[model samples]
Target: MHRGTNLPAVGGYNQALILDVIRRSGEGASRVELAEKTGLSAQTLSNVSRRLLDEGLIRESGKMVTGPGKPRTILRLEPEARFAVGVHLDPTVITYVVLDLEGHVVAHSRTRTPVGTKPEETIRRLTVSVNAIIETSGIDATRILGIGIAAPGPLDAEGGQVFNPPLMTEWHNVPLGASLAASTGLPVFVEKDVTAAVAAEQWMGALGDLKNSLFFYYGTGVGAGLVVDGAVVRGASSNSGDIGHLIVDPDGPLCRCGKRGCLGDSVAPVSLVLEAIEAGLVSAPTGELDSVTVDNDFTRLLSLADEGNGHAVVIVERAARRIARGVLAIVSILDVDRVVFGGPFWDRASRAYLGVVPGAVADDPALMMTHPIRFEQSKLGADVAAIGAGCLVLDRVLSPKPTDLLI
Candidate 1:
């Protein structure tokens, strides 16, 4: 529970703090209960609750006769009081979502990322798509707080730019955040895709209850999102989760980074598809493989492995082992007991990877942690990073930090 201050000047902080507690309370909370939980005086709680009710952020649901004197009215969060927009810029697809204050996705859309297009052209498309989705959702523009974007990293987050990501060759030092903000006319925040994934898991998924965990993101590229001491870790440059370069297999595959068997090159969807092509399990495309082509081929490879194809099984098993090895190193370093798996490609590979990874990590002689590790697949599905991006807007507006009390 977040404690509230009696100081008069920080009323805004108190209001946000109270609103946060009310939102988290599923059944709603009474003024007396809130005061008890937040360590606020009855008068202070009453003032904050009145402000929230006046702003339409919270409502008096009904009267609850709990044990004592008069009936206590339940104060519940008004979930639709505000909205947020989330956009995920993937190498293959761009996802957009509109989220209500309660973190529910009210609307969503997906578009294939423009291949061989200039960043300026792509941003124009993004602007058009964002406007279209907002209009289609029937949401009042005034109710929207802001837009948040999740993108591939090596981001200049402080400067609101996206440095050239490995998969996105055309996007070099792109001012994505500023450009989107200028076009959309809303406050915009940019976050690394994996970091946003973990943030979404923490905000809306079961991971919120855990103190420490790792979100192993398996997308076009492989990365990890970290949660330590119940907080998402965004390192110095807001590009913390870059596990792709971890050397998992020394003799496996040559990476663009001039290294052999890097975790990303060995287990990425494209790599798996290429391996399948080499092994005669998949037909190689006649022309250069675009994102869509690689996606389709990767799906085919997974389907073949699922159908008991011996060669496909070997490839998947090997990839799973390499992923496990990389995960082991990370888990050893972080000492987190919980590991979550999700991303665009995670669903297709979950059955195979899940079957191998948990046991492999547990049985490894070099495993560092004595406690049993728990693995879970994200319930947010493929659009998790997008949803998380929206949550960033909501979190910024509603969640109260101790720093807010710093005077």
Candidate 2:
């Protein structure tokens, strides 16, 4: 729990601290409860509560009687008081979501990502999409906090630049954040897609209660998002979760990095579709295999595996084992007891991967952890990363951080 100070200069922090407690209290909380949870003095709590009520951030619900004393008034958060926009820039798709103060997704939109387009043109289209979603949601523009973008890694997070993600060919050293901010006239934050996916899990998914966990993101590429001691791990460059190059299979598919059996190349959707085409499971497209074609073919491959096609099942099972191998290596090092799975391509592969991954991890001879590990599918669904990107805005504004109390 975050404590509040009565210092005059820190009133903003104190109000945020109090609101954090009230928002998490679910049904509602009384002044006494807020005081106990946040360690705020009655006078300070009263002042903060008045301010919150005046700002329409919280409201007094029906009174509740605890004992012989007067019934304490319950205070509840006004979720609609603030909103945020999150945008996820995937290699194959662009996802946008509008999230309320409570981190609930109120609106969403998705479009196929443009291929072979210049970075400037892509950013322009993205700006148009963001504006359209906000207008369609009918949210008060004044209530929006900001926009957050989750893109592929190798990001200059501090500079708000995308430093050439492997999958996004035209995005070499692009200032995505500044460009979007300029176009939309809102504050913009850029984060690695894997990092944002993990943030989404922690903020709105089942991983919130767990202190240590891993988010195994499956999309056009594969990566891991790490959380240790209840905090997302952004490494020195803010590109922490690139587990793609991990060598999982010695004789598997050759990767662009000139290596064979890398985790990413072995399990990515495009790779799977290509393999299926090679194995006569899926017909070769007349033209080049684009992201959209790969997406449809990947779904067909999964459907074939679901119907117990021997060749398709073998391909999926091999991919699952390769993913399990990569996951085991990380879990052994990080000692995280929980692993979450989600992303654009996760839904198609969930049943097959889930069936194999857990058992493979558990049965591995090289397993390190003595305790049992838990596996869960993301409840936030396919739009999780986008929702999390929006949560970035809410988290920045509402979550009480110790740094806020610095002198």
Candidate 3:
């Protein structure tokens, strides 16, 4: 069962609201600042401050001597007061991260995922990994709030179940959240990996206070995460952001879903590697390039492209162009001003894609009437989804939005 209710305590919502205000005020805020920002009475602010202080959620950091009668005590969040665990499940890898109250990753671990592994095996492996990290971190178990899991979608997030993700065909209808919770004795919150990545950007990224943006997540697969009004946009079934199937090229290769030139089949790592191999860039002495696994082939092609291999560069550029087309279509329809490119693929392909994608979007005629769009690389690197998962835990417990209020 999901241990923490989405609806926070009636007073809990107000307390969380104050804490959020403090967290954003990195320089610390006086009680007056809290009252002014939160629109709560001075008396209410005092009561909340006292409770937060007694609970150790917030602490008086220092005194700000304004133009005035007395030095005002400034308060700030105590990041070490609580923690959340984030797990990112990808077809190629599984990443775990422990995040403090302020969304900084304190500890992390990564392991290669066994493709086609059964759900039970994957669950067991995940449980052990989660236990090991928490045990080694030396943080008191009670202070650990809960676990957030970011898994590849087409998932039933509300139900804590994973459906048939494109790459991981074996994970059909797995009760991931309930099973993990039962195994670890902790609340488990599951989200689509792409949506979770968007949450990370919204919670702590360069795009602060920007209400609308799209995250183009390129991992073992290609997907998009949408944010509107500072909340992740999940379509009615909680499985939106499945941009992989959007047909980018009618004449391109066939996707695994039996469609022609779907986005997933176009720029997915496996698709890129297969393209490289077919183009003669991934050849070997034994003609055994086929023996190389998907990740290895993809990494080799990206490495070659980075080293200025002409063939590899051409392949990357083509992939970037295809990706740009998809991005342009998305930006035009959604009218999102900020577009972020990220995931494990970002680290290696940033140089290649950045060279072409921004120009591609900028040159598009659709932008003549709209404000200039900003294209950025992800600041959180590969940990974006994992951190976002952790943020999901923190957001449920600490964010002060109206949805958390029980009217």
- Pairs that collide in candidate 2 are none
Compared with the true structure, what per-residue lDDT tens digits does model 1 show for residues 224-303? 99999989999999999899989999988998889999999999999999999999998989999879989999999999
Where does candidate 3 stray beyond 4 Å? Answer: 1-9, 284-292, 365-369, 401-404
lDDT of 3: 0.85
- Please write out the lDDT profile of model 2 over residues 1-407, one tens digit for every residue: 67788888888799888888887788999999999998889998999999999999999999999989999999999999989999999999999999988888889999999999999999999999999999999998888899999999899977889998999888889999999999999999988999999998888745567589999999999888899999999999999999999999999989899999999989999999999999999899999999888989999999999999999999999999999999999999999999999999998799999999999999999997889999898887789789878988888888887888888
If scored against the real structure, what TM-score would every candidate get?
A: 0.97, 0.97, 0.92
Alpha carbon lDDT of each predicted model: 0.91, 0.91, 0.85
> Candidate 3, 40: how far from true, in Å?
2.4
Model 2 lDDT, residue 354, Cα:
100
Global lDDT of model 2 = 0.91
Error of 1 at 359 (Å): 1.5
Give per-residue CA lDDT, model 3, range 1-407, as digits (tens): 01122222456777888888888888889998788787777777888889999999999998998896889999999999999999999887899999999999999999888755699899999999999989899889898999999999888888999988867878788999999999999999999999999989888855666577889999988888998766679899878888888887788799778999888889888788878978898753354333237667788898899899998998888888889888988887787888998997778788889999999878867554258778887899999999989999999888766665546
